[model samples]
Target: MDKNQLGVQYMQEGNWEEAAKAFNDAIEENPKDPVAYINFGNVLSAVDDDEKAVKFYQKAIEIDEHAGAAYYSIGNVFFTQDRFTEAKKMFETAMKKGLESSDNFFMLGLTLVQLNQGKLALPYLQRSVELNEHDAEARFQYGLCLAQLELIDEAILQLEKCIELDPDHSDAFYNLGVSFAFKETSVKAIEMFNKALEIQPDHLLAGHAKKLIENNL
Candidate 1:
């Protein structure tokens, strides 16, 4: 097989050094191949060499300006560094260049949320859950975005679905409790909080919420 294929195989086996060497060989094999640069960048990224990763990704973009995977990789590096603005830009460019994945959508949506642009994040988060409905984390985030928009019923559904998918998800139960509390459904809120606490006994917020609900009722 080709160097790129060997590189991918090494990566799949978690052999970082061999993977990097194979990818380096792949790049040398076809210096103008954007895919080689992107794959090299992926190896660097997996090794947490964000600075070097960006260089390879940029090289890929230089070779082919429409390298969506390169842009998405850059976005991931930026997002991890908390440079959400640049991350958002790169992710948007990736999407424009035909990058489509549940992870990409989820990260872009999460970046928007971190930027305090939850309203704008709604559609991306919704799309993420649509693409991977079994992802409890995505469902939890989608639920929060809906709650922020006062779409209580919609938020409740997502949070409930999250709990169904992962019964040990304490935060999902806690958020569901908060949603119910926001709607003045005290009994239901208390029950949700109790469930959350049951799942995670050390969940301080859940314990507090349960007591607060009981006292008020």
Candidate 2:
């Protein structure tokens, strides 16, 4: 239909060149359209050109100061580049600008986790899980942050929820095993380790833990 819609279609099809052309046309038609700039940024981000993508996203913000997606896009680039502090600021700004995506909250929480502030990460990660309970990765990260805080029982719940959401999540099982071990529940810990190994036979850590548990260590 329109250049913006066409650009989105091309982007979904993984045709960066055509997507760029369509976005460029949209921008040429209306330089003030923040959405066009955001779409252009999406294409740049898809092609792993984060530096250029940041320019486009920043332009979108300049065009419309409240464009939350623009802020979120920049935050994603920062995250990819391991600029956790900057990414946290961008993500927080996105929320203040009214972007309510579960992934936005997840990324913000994960950034705090990266910054080694698990206590601060807790609320954001909890909100992420509340918004989208089916996201196993979010649950897993929340579980991990809980474990870092020595909230082992709460961590077990989150890890179990992660496993419930994704039965094949080897990390969830392995971590659950570790959590049980911390509670001195050796049999349950062994079971979880065994389950992890069953799902991933080459899980070295799980194998090691399972052996130790079986020997009553």
Candidate 3:
């Protein structure tokens, strides 16, 4: 395989040192290849060297202004640091630069959610789910945003799909319970809460909601 592809394989195996070395070799072979710089930046990011990672990403961007993956990598670093606004800008730029990957859309949506702009996050989250139907987290997040927007039915559908994709996801069960409760289907809500508790006995919200409903009944 080519050095860049080998680097990516190393990265997938979580061998950051080897990945970095492979990427370094790739860069040496082709100094202007933005992909190598972005791959190296990812390795740096994996090692928690955020400052170095950003520099590498910036170098990739400098080499090719259209390096959408570089912007996406920088966005991930900013997101981890809770720099929501900067993360949002980077993700947006990635999107504008033709990064139509599901991950990029998901990160942008999540950034908007972190910034308390759930309304604005909805479409992006929906697009992310549309792009990758098997992504349980994306579906869960979309469900959550829909619930927050008082679109209970839509929330329930997404949460149910999320649960189907990942049956062990306690949070999805709990959220499904909440959505059912919003629709006044107390029996279904209680069943969902019980399922959540079965998956995660320490699910505080599910426990509380179950107790509250029992008391009322």
Candidate 4:
């Protein structure tokens, strides 16, 4: 395999040192290749070297102004740092640079959610789910954005699909309980809360909601 592909395989195996070596070789082989710089940045990012990662990503961008993956990687760094506004900008730029991946849409949507712009986040999150139907986390986030908008039924649908894709998702179960409670379906709400508790015994929200509902009933 080529050095870049070898680097990616090493990354997938969680061998950061070898991945870095492979990427370094790739960069040495072709200094103008933006993909190598991006891959190197990803290694640094995985290792929690955010500052160095950003520098590598910047180098990729310098080599290729239209490098969408570089922008996307930088956005991820900002997102992990909770710099949501900056993350939003980078993801938007990535989109404008022709990166229409599901992950780009998801990150942008998630950034908007972090910024308390649920209404704005909804469409991007929806598009992410449309692009990758099997992504449980995307479904869960879309459900959360819907819930925040007071679209409880739609939220419940998404949350249900999330749990179907990932049955052990306690958060989805807990949120499902909340959605059912909003519909005044106490029994179903309690059942969902119990399911959440079964999955995660220390789910405080689910426990509290169950008690609150029982007391009211």
What is the TM-score of each predicted model, taking all chains together? 0.91, 0.92, 0.98, 0.99
What residue runs in model 3 are displaced by over 4 Å at the alpha carbon? none
At residue 77, what lDDT does model 1 achieve? 96
Candidate number that wins on lDDT, 2 or 4 = 4
Q: Write the per-residue lDDT of candidate 3 for residues 70-106, one digit (tens) a residue.
A: 9999999999999999999999999999999999999
For residues 30-72, could you state the per-residue lDDT of candidate 4 as single tens digits?
9999999999999999999999999999999999999999999
Number of the top TM-score candidate: 4
Kindly list the per-residue Cα lDDT of model 2 for residues 1-118, writing each as its tens digit: 9999999999889999999999999999999999999999999989899889999999999999999999999999999999999999999999999999899999999999999999
Query: By TM-score, highest first, what's the ranking?
Result: 4, 3, 2, 1
lDDT, model 3, position 50: 93
What is the lDDT of every predicted structure here?
0.93, 0.95, 0.96, 0.98
Candidate 1 C-alpha error for residue 169, in Å: 1.8
Q: Supply the TM-score for candidate 3.
A: 0.98
For candidate 3, list the clashing residue pairs, or say none: none
Error of 3 at 117 (Å): 1.0
